[model samples]
Target chain A: MQDRYVAYAIDITDPDDPRVDNFRNLTNADRRPDRPGGKGLVIGEGTIVVERMAGTRFSPTELLGVPRKLNELQAVLQDKNVPYFCASPEVMAKIVGFHLNRGVLAVSPRPAPLHYDSVLAGARTIAVLEGIGDHENLGALFRNAAALKVDGFLLGPRCSDPLYRRSVRVSMGHVLRIPYATIDDWGTALEALAKYDFHTVALTPQHPSDTLADTIAVPKVAFFLGAEGAGLSETALRAAHRRARIPMTPGVDSLNVATAGAIAFYERSRLTEQQAK
Target chain B: MQDRYVAYAIDITDPDDPRVDNFRNLTNADRRPDRPGGKGLVIGEGTIVVERMAGTRFSPTELLGVPRKLNELQAVLQDKNVPYFCASPEVMAKIVGFHLNRGVLAVSPRPAPLHYDSVLAGARTIAVLEGIGDHENLGALFRNAAALKVDGFLLGPRCSDPLYRRSVRVSMGHVLRIPYATIDDWGTALEALAKYDFHTVALTPQHPSDTLADTIAVPKVAFFLGAEGAGLSETALRAAHRRARIPMTPGVDSLNVATAGAIAFYERSRLTEQQAK
Candidate 1:
């Protein structure tokens, strides 16, 4: 008898196969993996991200890949009963509406988003993002957070969906691992943060703010970051307990949002790690 | 008789105008601004970068832009005698082989490369790269270096040119201002760094390495960095005065090369600035 996975593997010779429709024309805005029929659907590109999807709370419903990648992903797929739509690279390219060198894809339904309290509980250090609309920046921030040991993210208004395909891929699948929640209002979030005994500091370029180094000693900290241009809104800045700036050379534009967040996280990690020692 | 400035501004209705040939089909490998006919050509995109080019050593030989951008650049162009090839957006797009929303492009011949000693002089902190092939990352490093006040770059083997159009734009034109030089051999470059009283430190993810903060107190520091995956070459690592790492969470990949460099530069900047006080 053939193994169970042998039965689950379906050959997809035609790009138009309905069985693989979920992976089709991915560049289209409406059918984006992040949104299907107004609901969220997560897509992971490449073996690494697909493995991340398999390992996380979001188990992929199906997979599309060339034979090489499918074979490589055997260990990652052993625990799941998801169907593998094996296709040629050319057919895969046709379905995806562009050439994807990664050679593998995984699709999962986006789950209910986490709540602020759920994500904040027991977390010592967290990052709060405001108006970070760029998906790549959102993704990079999560990647940096994962590497620097930030516990979670609390997103304020105008933040883009972290489950978007580009975000997932750019985060190198770390977005799947780093828990985050969206806040309905900055005021409520700030109030909640205060109750948690967290020191909330806004990262901005404005002078008269304390340097990030001087503000990193608090036990529970949530560093707030904003988009590149039109930085944190006046409301977000005024509401925070403190404002801190990453000192830099004069005459240069501020660091990229993701880079700025990474620096803050690094500084926090360094000082806190040393304090523990 | 019209003013001399009016004569300098030439209107072009055709995409194939020979006068604007240097800006033609810029996306093509042969016509790429970074390497045209095997000689370096620096290109600045958008109004901001072109304005930067105007103020730097790389003055634009000619400019191609729409009426609005041309009018905006009048002050920048006042001192220069370069011809302005004004065209409609559609015509400009056709000539460039793509829709460039930047609305303006400037081309200038690359100046002779600087020497390692020249870029290394009077530098308290500097960043050195080995085998960094990504243009965007290279550009971002310069952007970060400029912001953090790193002196300049001493490029080892396999670094991509920062004068590429994409790098210039990604760097927000900071690449044009930041001085960099290529080296023939890593051994010779490290020797020169030693004589300059530079304490060379390799930033890697390797274990048993000193934390960046521990190594930040050196008088003249040169941080050596490499590409993301294949880090600094074994030879370069062994030759460095010290090996250091930015403390990161377990099992997570190291930060992006550019981000890592930024943190190193930031740490050096923070400590040095503190010491100065």
Candidate 2:
């Protein structure tokens, strides 16, 4: 029987070493895994996110950190045979092209994308996102979804890659754990969801007939969210089964996209828990 | 009566002009209004925030922007006699030490602080913040407070000043509109709150007996929130009349401070509206 616990610790004093090229120049836009010219690496930062990535299906291919963080992650690293590249903070910062105060980073290749049908198979409540282009907001939405009991995320259009470095950090690494898939066609996606008996709720501030709390008691539900200023596209809104609004003060502009989603998810959780009781 | 509609449009071509000194070096830490050895100037950015400042007690003492923003703000500027300093975007960017895409900026002298008693008076729903030192979270809390009909905010220990430039921008200038007062003594503040018959509910993740929805129905309610990782202090938890929590999925960490506060505020709004209906 092969041993599951394999530890390979490599100490690299040189910042320009090719062995650590995967962790280089992280701030450059072209280095983003989702971009055409970029290496499609899933980067996780900080101890918590790094630990989470180790536990997820996307195993870290390599890690670069100061001695302290490497020691902290020793337990999680024990089971994996990945190389742990130990370097001083200065060398690590030089290699990454920024002062990464988190003192730790792990990089992995993107995992196989989850199928929409699989994500929906046993899901009770989900978030269907359209045009959530901001990485921080997208990550925050995933965090909210995880905390509020939404089962998964279904990306419709214009959503940034959830595995992006900033998203991973901002989400507290929740993006790695929460299952997600992208839809090529909104119309077909809605039709597919309807066939699965999911009630699609489009959240909008404009002319919403029902409050989100009123619409959250369904057996299967998906709340659709949009970008900050433009909101959900008309086609996406029309495709949903129902429209709901989180009641707001009359003169104030709409809530931030993620905050609005959190309210919807919270309401769903509250209602479903009450019903269960 | 002295004319209130005086328009002083100054076109300064030099970045080092002393007249626009107040808007200079915005990114420098020493320029922070809340920091020691800093000029105590409240700065507002973008058209929306500047417009909101015009509508709030924090009146802009001076304004700087491109011609486009100047034209857009004409209606708001008509009633105020403050100097409107217009410059080219390039020149304005040099003066502010960054390429501020917002295209507009406003500066005001800090207003006299609000009294805690005044903030609590006539308020039905309020947020009491402890150790919310993050400027973005502090600002987002104010924005959420404004949207969800929270009447005011009471600052406990270690809360950042909402009037700081980053907070002002993040709050969408809602911090200028929301009434807030600092509490020198938490014990006395609690006593004062009790005199007004406000239910002091501390939101904690540890062993909360009642859910937020269960406690939000009071005539007057105050939700206490702590910083992100370190929740409400032990002193704060004991100081509250009751402890309530937002139920979460097991094994997940607590929600972001601002998001948690928003959920609590949303529940309060929902319950109050339901009762009113």
TM-score of each: 0.96, 0.96
Which residue runs does candidate 2 get wrong by more than 4 Å?
A: A1-6, A33-36, B1-6, B32-36
Error of 2 at B206 (Å): 1.0
* lDDT of all predictions: 0.86, 0.88
What is candidate 2's lDDT per residue for A175-264, written digit by digit as tens?
999999988678767876887799999999889558888787889999999998899999988888889988789989889999999999
* Docking category of candidate 2: high
lDDT of 2 at A203: 95
What is the Cα-based lDDT of residue B60 in candidate 2?
Answer: 93
How well is each residue in B1-277 modelled by candidate 1, as lDDT tens digits? Answer: 5243631689999998899888887876554434457446777899888888887789899998887788778778887888988899999998888999999999898887887778888888888899988989999999999889898888888888778777888888988888888885887887889889899999999977998989879889989999998999998899888999998998888899999999999888888878888
Candidate 2 — which pairs collide? none
- Candidate 2 residue lDDT tens string, B1-277: 5432245788979999999999998998666555697887899999999989887789898999887788788778887888888899999999999999999999988878998788889999999999999999999999999999999998988888788889988999999998999885688778878878899999988895588888778899988899999998889999887899787898898899999999998999988889999
What RMSD, rounded to one decimal, does every model reach? 2.3, 2.9
Q: Residue B5 of candidate 2: its Cα lDDT?
A: 28
